[model samples]
Target chain A: MQQFKTLKDLPEQDYFTGGSSACAGCGPSMGLKLALKVLGPETIIVNASGCMTLLPLYPNTPLKASWIHNAIENASSTAAGARHGLDMLGNKDMNVVVYAGDGATYDIGLASLSAVAAKNERIIYICYNNQSFGNTGFQWSTATPYGSETKTTPRGKNNPTGTTAVNKDMVKIMGAHRVYAATASLAYPVDFLNKLSRAKERDGFSYIELLGACTAGWNYDPRLTIRISKLAVRCGMWPMYEIENGILTLNKDFSELKPIDEFLKLQGRYRALPQDGVDRLQVLINEHWAELKEYNGQRYV
Target chain B: MKQTLVTGNEAAAWGARLVRPNYIPTFPITPQTECIETLARWSADGELPGTYFDRMESEHSVMSAAVGAAAVGARVFTASSSQGLLLMHEVLYIAAGMRLPIVMATISRGLSAPVTLWSDHNDFLDQRDSGWLMFHAENNQEVLDMMLQAYRIAEDPRVLLPAMVNMDGYVLSFTDEPITIPSPEMVEEFLPEYNPDHTIAKGRPVTVGPPVLDEYTIFRAQNHVAARNALEVMEEVMDDFDRIFDRRYHLVDEFMLDDAELVLVTQGSMSTTAKAAIMEMREEEGIKVGLLRLRVIRPWPAKAIAEALKGAKAVAVIDRNLAPGRGGIMFPEIVETLYHLDRRPLVSSFVVGLGGNPQTEHKVKEITRKLIDDLETGRPRVEWNDL
Candidate 1:
């Protein structure tokens, strides 16, 4: 695995190029681009049915690496097959990575993902989570944070809280499988690339759920994609952490978390959030942050 | 060649072992569990040196892994029955659409509403439109032989499609019968190393099963054409199988069809019972009865079927599967195939032996007598024999 300590140390050759229908400053697309720098061209990107599935409009694909789109809930199982197949064919050096969405990873494809992780197969799995089912016009998913408003969870007269369900902790769920699990942000390229390198080096399943801050779904300025992503990490909403061999390590430590209001105010998805909802969300974030801090450098899950 | 007493599940496992599939992703299901168990035992004992026998969480993942493995140019094999086959239904089409040559053993069982773990064609026949080259076997020997032929035909460049070799559950899967397990060297001579030019490997960048717009119809047409192409590939594979192992097979198996005026169209293990009844009728009752067993269901052997039943005055289509309001599934297919012939046989529909109902010789003779009556009346009947 090639170590890239800084942005300048990263490889210059790009495998994911221009020419798709991806939204401007598409965080998932950027995550994939940086992932290819770590994975290189000798990789097979197993994609599930989601927004990125529409990346390759017929006869045209931005990815130089091989891509396999199996179905809505089978990117992990499909990647498992590709990894085993390549290994049996004596081409064991090539990478078989899955690039799926939150809907695929946290919801539909969760069983497939857990089974593969339990087996400790040598494959890198990346969940490009944009918070909601962003492809389907911002429908709420289990990954959707509380107080956020997706189309399905609209702030109406009956329900003012909008998204009431607590967000699923994907990192803890994956770490419980005894495989390397981490969280990445599009704002931090070097950290994500370094985690990608670590996942590449492991001869077992490694999961990295990268926060893909959506421009279209979140109704944010395309230019604020990075700012929103950075705010997510700094505000303790989306922590930068990794769990290796049951030990959790905080990648970005802070003296105090920034206010969650700035992160919520930037996205239209949270514009309808009331004062009480905002306070509730802040309490939830603080509670989660406390747990992570207590478990830091300790055996997690 | 070694003649040994084995179950149909063992026969399938032997076929997979002889062909030396590099990957065998499996999940346990009734009637199909022993097949994977045998492979798992071999993998554990180090008897299968190059094989990776992986036990998956479900049949869906088993097939998904198979597609992944086959897409990367590895010979892949798996087995399932009833609901297990249904669970893998979605990926089966994807496997065919991707043109991955995966050979799977489908041990047929009755579908559930009220579940039965016995032999039936519903589970197998339900996958008729999945774009797989379908082969149903009469006995354990044919079960093993078709597995060898399935790989040969599927891997052919013209075909490049997945194949499902099915045998009835319990009767074939658990019951023991004498079969000649072909030598590994013979299978090696017959099936070449799987080296697909379309797979994904190092330094070879290609997209598979990508989203297509107008080209969706084109890919579907190609799927249909490739399956149709397997009709020719079957002949070549049959010839090679005969030359290598001296076991001759055909797209449609015929028994006493030359001088017979009464014919019974059957499939799977029930054909053996039907053939026995036909012989007793020929000797005692003096009824000139024969049987035409449908081996290949997909890429339906329409020509062979028409020619086989051309001379018959009446044909009884005995189906071990039912289509609810639509009588027997194969009854329509047979009638459709014979429609263009100059002299079509009087084909009657008979749905029987569902959910492993014992397909006794008594029922066979009764069906033959019904066919005789239908011929005399010159009017066909659609009836369920169990009633």
Candidate 2:
């Protein structure tokens, strides 16, 4: 994985196109490009209706591989078909990748996805979690952080709890399936690409949840997207790790973790928070990081 | 080539074997399960190299695996029956809509709920509009023949759509019949190895599916029309098969429908029984009741069907499966296919023998009498038999 320093270091074939409907500096699109670079072109990508769906257009779908435009709730099943078809054809040297939005993968397509993982179908499924349904206007998604305001979740003084529930732990949910499951950050392209490469080589179901920075939905400056993306991993807000057959392998351990404010203050979605509000978020982040550290340290023994 | 007595299910499995598919994903469903198991055995024996045999959790996953593999440019095969086919409903459309040539064999069985595993066309008939090319076989030989033809037509660059080759469960799948096994060399000549030029290329980059606006969506959807090109390609393949292997399949087969006052429409195994009954009636009382077997269901072939029953006074469609409140499933489709003809013949539908109930030749003979009697008396009410 380290041998490939950049997308340019790999094959000249760029699977994800440069221009599309995705917002400028959208982290998900960049992550998608890097992900495809690792999987290569002998791949069939199944995409649910999302920003990615609209980003790639005719004559120039940001993909250099076979692709299917699946319904929001059926991307997992659609990719399952691609996996099944590939195996039946005696073509063992290719990969099937399914990409979906948080709203699609977590809220709606979860059952279908669970079915695939339970069967352990040979394929790679990626969920680009922007924390909201950005495709059909910014709406609340299961992955939406505890304190966030969207068209659906309007900010009101009385509604102290910005969201009703805690963030859905997709990595943990997928990890429980006993297949390869990992969390990647758009801020860390190399690590994201490395996990994806390993996922491609491994048989059975492998999943990656990418915390992609949504420039439009998050209401952040286009140029600050990468910086904000990087801040997520730096603040220990988004831990980078992998779980292989129930064995947790922490990819990166942030020793001098920055204050959570560095990541949350930058995004307009969370800009309404005051100093005390920010402190509460920091405490929650610390609690999650400690839990992950304990989980990663313990082995089957 | 060595000749063997095999059922339609075995023939389909053997035909699949010749292609040397890489992956065989399937579930254990009646009638179709034998075909999947046969492939599983071949895959396990290493008779075919570099193949992956998957015991899919469900029929949906079976088709899902096929779509995924086909996208990555794998030649794939699978078989399913009534309930399994219905379960795989959504993925079926995705496979065809994506323009992947995934060839599948379906042994038709009645859909469940008072479950019985017997021969019925209701399973495949329900999915007549999923954009996959549909073909029915009246016997074991056609099963083998259509399987080969399906690969040729489906893989054609002009018609990159999935296709289903259907034969009746128990009736054709279990009944032993002498089949003419074409020499592998002849089959190779008739149907070449599937080589898809427009596939996922590692060296170059191209997007296969991207979002399109309204008009472009329709434009992209016109691939369904492009698939219509296979109608002629199917005919040409049949012509070539006749030239080399001495077997010809009419897109729609007709039996004595000409010069007959009453015509009976049926599919799959029932067509075979209807043919026997027509022959028996011709021998006994010389009653002129003929049979029209619909071989191609999708792309309906409306004009061909109308032309086949042009001079007939009445057409009785024996639907072995019900559409619930709507009599027989095929009956309505057959009637709809010829509704535009000026002075169209009286079309009648009968919903009978559901849930795999055996439709004996006596039932067809009884149907012939009812249809003939109704044609003479001009009965206003359509017959709905619950046999």
What is residue B364's positional error in candidate 1, in angstroms?
A: 0.7
Poorest stretch of ten by lDDT in candidate 1 chain B: B194-203
Model 1: lDDT to the true structure: 0.92
Q: Candidate 1's residue-wise lDDT over B1-387, tens digit each?
A: 798999999999999998889999999999899999999998899988788899788888999999999989999999999999999999999999999999999999999989899988988888999999999998999999999999999999999999999999988999999999887888888988888898887788989888888888998999999988999889988998899989899889999999999999999998888888889999999999999999999999898999888999999999999999788999999999999989888989999998889999999999999988998899999999997
Model 2 reaches an interface RMSD of: 3.4
Which CAPRI quality tier does the interface of model 1 achieve?
A: high
Clash counts for the predictions, in order: 0, 28
Q: How does candidate 2 score on lDDT?
A: 0.79
**Candidate 2, CAPRI quality class derived from DockQ:** acceptable
TM-score list, all predictions: 0.99, 0.86
TM-score of 2: 0.86
Q: Least lDDT summed over 10 consecutive residues: which range in candidate 1 chain A?
A: A1-10
